[model samples]
Target: MTAGVETQASAKVSAPSASRVRVEAAAPRPNMGWIVPTLYILFLMLPIYWLVNMSFKTNTEITGTFSLWPQNPTLRNYIVIFTDPAWYSGYINSIIYVVMNTVISVAVALPAAYAFSRYRFLGDKHLFFWLLTNRMAPPAVFALPFFQLYSAFGLIDTHIAVALAHCLFNVPLAVWILEGFMSGVPKEIDETAYIDGYSFPRFFARIFVPLIASGIGVAAFFCFMFSWVELLIARTLTTTAAKPIAATMTRTVSASGMDWGVLAAAGVLTIIPGALVIYFVRNYIAKGFALGRV
Candidate 1:
């Protein structure tokens, strides 16, 4: 009897129930969800890849015939950009103003955002709306006004002039973003700091700012990106001394006409700074989007 029971148990273990096998067969395979995003990414990367490919080819190869890859690759385009004073100076000028603008915008926005998040004053909403309106207005509207004003002060072609001009747009955006993050922080922390005899500045600097650091990163990123990319006003307010890379690209014509190779190389170089900024701040930006606590 014991031998019969042991043999029956072994048979049951050796063969899974027909129902279990049917259930396993019925399980759905994973859908190709990755396909759409992969295609979309490829679509976006195509132009960038083409630009890089063209940057290596000579102008003769670019226009003379269409090719996926450079038949005879050369670094002449990149060499020209690095070697030429005018070409390289444009990049320097852009960085000078962009960094200045990001710093100024975030600094100004922090105090204003703190007030908005913590205080409840008359017309606060109205004032905040007015701040956003400045950002909403097209850069073109202020281009002429800024040019005339900067000229009157003899600030044309100066880095500070461009930095200040960008602040008009950047400050409001920074303020809006920082306000949202500040609001997420509980007011109890402020009360606790005060009870410990901490001054407003001391508490803000030592305790409060650290809690909302991600917000600051997000604001600075936007400010840098805006100042780096803005063209019409940057071009209008400057000529030789403070011309940005964007304006320089527009003027990259030679006796043979547009230097396509050089332009492509410059474009590839121009994307590097913004890419680096995003890479460094990517984590902070993610935290900021989640309101730092979510």
Candidate 2:
């Protein structure tokens, strides 16, 4: 009798387990929502893939073929860019001005950002807005004035001229970005450092700067990208000696028509520096948004 009772009790327990297994199996699975984003990413990449495809083909093949890829892949387009002085110097000049602009913009913006975030002065709000207005003004508006000013100083056709001209836009953006990040840091940090006998400059350099390193990285990345790609000011401020790659690419067009393959190759090369910059600062960019400091 006891054995039969024990068997009945075991069966009761097993019944609930079997019912739960059935319930779980009957539950609805998540929908495949991921398909939309995957499709969108592929769509965005299609033009880039086409550009790369054209870069590897001869100009004649590019016009003649309807194929998705190069029919006869060749490196002659890239070879021309690397081996030619005019083509390669454009890249060197671009890098020089871009790096100079990024560094100068960031350095100047950092102190101004700190001032905006940490202190209040007369007309501070108006001053800040005025700075942003400079950024908002079209580069075309300043191109003539910049050319005339740089000409007066005998600074035309130099990398430094382009770097300084780009600063007119980039400095404001850097200040705006860095100011946002600096405001997120607590005022208590300043107080604590003062209590420990740290001077203002020393505290700011050693203590405050590290806290907002990610913000600086993000700001620098923006500065770098803007200066790298701004064709109008860079082109206007420079001629042959310091002409950027964007301006150099214009040479591909002639009375004979465009050299499609070489133009495509130049476009591909132009993407590399920006791509490398993004890769290096990607972590900082991700962190900046997460920390609400971007």
Candidate 3:
């Protein structure tokens, strides 16, 4: 009887201790994971903060001193950008070409990527390398040839000219990214779709496309970014009517003087399309990198 009572007491004591231990173990620890990310975010945002601040200031304030914030904040810069047809037209032109470049790059790249991912043909490896080599070539090397080629084709100074020119680099990059993501998808899915009496085109359009949708988003974002920022080829391809925002920015700085306020405003405006694009694609970026297709 005495031993049984002692054993019960010991068991009761140990059970509470075990439960306490488990409760403690299940609790989250203080992590330093946020430290590096926080610092990196601050670093990236600082330049943007400065640009926005400077945009609000007058030319005198901007030239006079380097202030963290504008002393006398004004919307004149924005007003100028909105009111001027020339300034706004550049934005419109840029949008047209950038969208064209992105659509063409992704549309062409998707099939090429799918081919590379799914099949083995003669010299397929060589072809893939050749396509990627276009990206490796310096843009300067292609500028003169592109100019002459577009001139010959009567595509010079057109949005299509800029869009096609951008494809020289963007298409290669899009293909590579899409190929990586597509390769990660399981081949079983294709087989299953085939066994279910789905036609190749139907299966690819319905099943395969959705599986790698994240990859498509990522490729499109990169294509848009590259084509948007590229100035050399854009300038080379288009003269006035289809001139990109980058070339228009050059007009601000000439032999006479720089239009600081207008330039700042243009710079800020240039960032908007990219920012909105990234915002929309931000969720897919992680999955895109993971190449996680069902």
lDDT of candidates 1 onward, in order: 0.91, 0.91, 0.88
User: Model 3: how far is 225 from its true place, Å?
Assistant: 1.2
TM-scores, all models, native as reference: 0.88, 0.87, 0.86
TM-score-based ranking: 1, 2, 3
Number of the candidate with higher TM-score, 1 or 2:
1
**Reference-based TM-score, model 1:** 0.88
Ranking by lDDT: 2, 1, 3
lDDT of 2 by residue, 74-154 (tens): 999999999999999999999999999999999999999999999999999999999999899999999999999999999
Clash tally, candidates in order: 0, 0, 0
Residues 1-294, candidate 3, lDDT per residue (tens digit)? Answer: 557877999887764544335454443877778899999999999988888888899988889888888889999999988898878889999999999999999999988999999999999999999998999989899999999999999999899999999999999999999998889888999999999999999998999999888899999988998999999989998888898887888888757477787788889999999899889988987776554432
Q: After superposition, how far is residue 143 of candidate 1 from its true place, in Å?
A: 1.2
lDDT per residue as tens, model 1, 6-123: 7899887775656646544444788788899999999999999999999999999999999999999999999999999899999999999999999999998999999999999999
